[model samples]
Target: MSGTRRLFAELAILGGLILVLAALGPFGSYATPLGPRLLHWALYLVTGYAFFRPVIAAGSALARQMGMSRLVAIAVACVLGAFPTNVIFVFAAAGPAWRSVTASDLAGAYLQTLIVGATVTIVQLLAERGAVPASPAPPTPALPDPQPAAAADATEQEVAPALLDQLPPHLRGPILCLENEDHYVRVHTLHGSALVLIRMRDAVAQLEGQGERVHRSWWVARRAVAGAVRQDRNWKLRLIDGREVPVARASVADLRVLGWLGDAPPAA
Candidate 1:
């Protein structure tokens, strides 16, 4: 399914689940009126999903680059995210009187929300992992060659790879990078970015060594690196379009091999 359609479907499922949960009124929420109870759970579930989904996705990607296991990454992400999410939830739940909120209240709420968040994140991850089949043979499409760009006015333009073809025609300019966002792979070109429901590994393979995997969730084309930036101990490639793509610490040696960086001391 297309990325947008798949997202809608997932939201629909979550919506239905919320309705069921609200009706059942788990915990002491049963005492609240139906209308308020429904609203409360909807706010809780929807907000949790929207907030933590990206954190878990990005955290997992970073953790993989750090050589941590996926489950360990998810656990760390949930633990770290729980505090901020709980704070927001409490403030929203307690509105105008937010100042009355106490540390104990936050502690109690954090534990409860952490369980729910961890459960939801894990289930979603497992579902995604199971949905992905073993990688099939890479598709063969005529990827644009670097040589053709010198003669920009050539009548016979090289076709973009199968991955790039998935983008809308207008956004099919030279690909600057690819980013793994949740279950979708975002294809970024100078024109713009659009997400496709493809695995990051599969997407990188389709590039056929034309691009470099600078991070677990990011792949960058050679021509796209306009410069490099060193931020403290971390590094990133400044893309031609002015976006910074992170360089995984684990992949630093590989980047050195590519000569993207030179002997520069990290910030003191």
Candidate 2:
């Protein structure tokens, strides 16, 4: 899914939580009128999302470019973002007078928003991760792996993935795999490789049953695999073009489950 659709899906998930929270009425809000309490929680939660998410997402992207952990960046952004978001929440909690907000009260409110922000961030991240299955183009009748003689027929019938359209005409042939290089992902096609100014995750998400990420920085098309190479406890996918893409140990079981590893042998 594109970012906008993903955002809507995430907000819909949040909407469900909002309904439950409003019904339960936490934080001593049970005494308030149901209508006002629902509105208050919605404003507080949604505004907090608007405030923290952009900064956190940007910080995570910058961190990746800077060769830093996104978790560290998210922690920093969530903590720092809490201050301003808390201001909005404090003002929204109109029962407490502005003048009555003591330094200790401000501190407590800050702490509360920080915790809530972190929780919401975790939920949103999980939502995006869970949304992967919703991507990929609609399923079509599976075809046999391409062969040299059938290449022309396959090309004529195959609906090109949107991602390949970004490549140059000459390089828009069979996709082998993707390799990440800092800010860009190098698209390895059967014709030749070229760098595309798109993130590896986004590129993989755009693929329509052509490939999947078998490693943190690599995505491989199953049909392009020549064989698997074992290096002691490590594993690598040897492609038809003689390129070896490292396979993450964690992804080994998934590959085995999908029949990428012939007969579901042990990962190691």
Cα RMSD to the true fold for all candidates: 8.5, 12.9
Clashes of each: 0, 0
TM-score of 2: 0.49
lDDT of each residue in 142-230, candidate 2, tens digit only: 22354563473255235445666667665666667887755567777766766677877788776657666887777887677766778
TM-score of each: 0.56, 0.49
Pairs clashing within candidate 1: none
Candidate 1 on 245-264: residue-level lDDT in tens? 88889888988877766543
- Model 1's alpha-carbon lDDT is 0.69
Model 1 TM-score on a 0 to 1 scale:
0.56
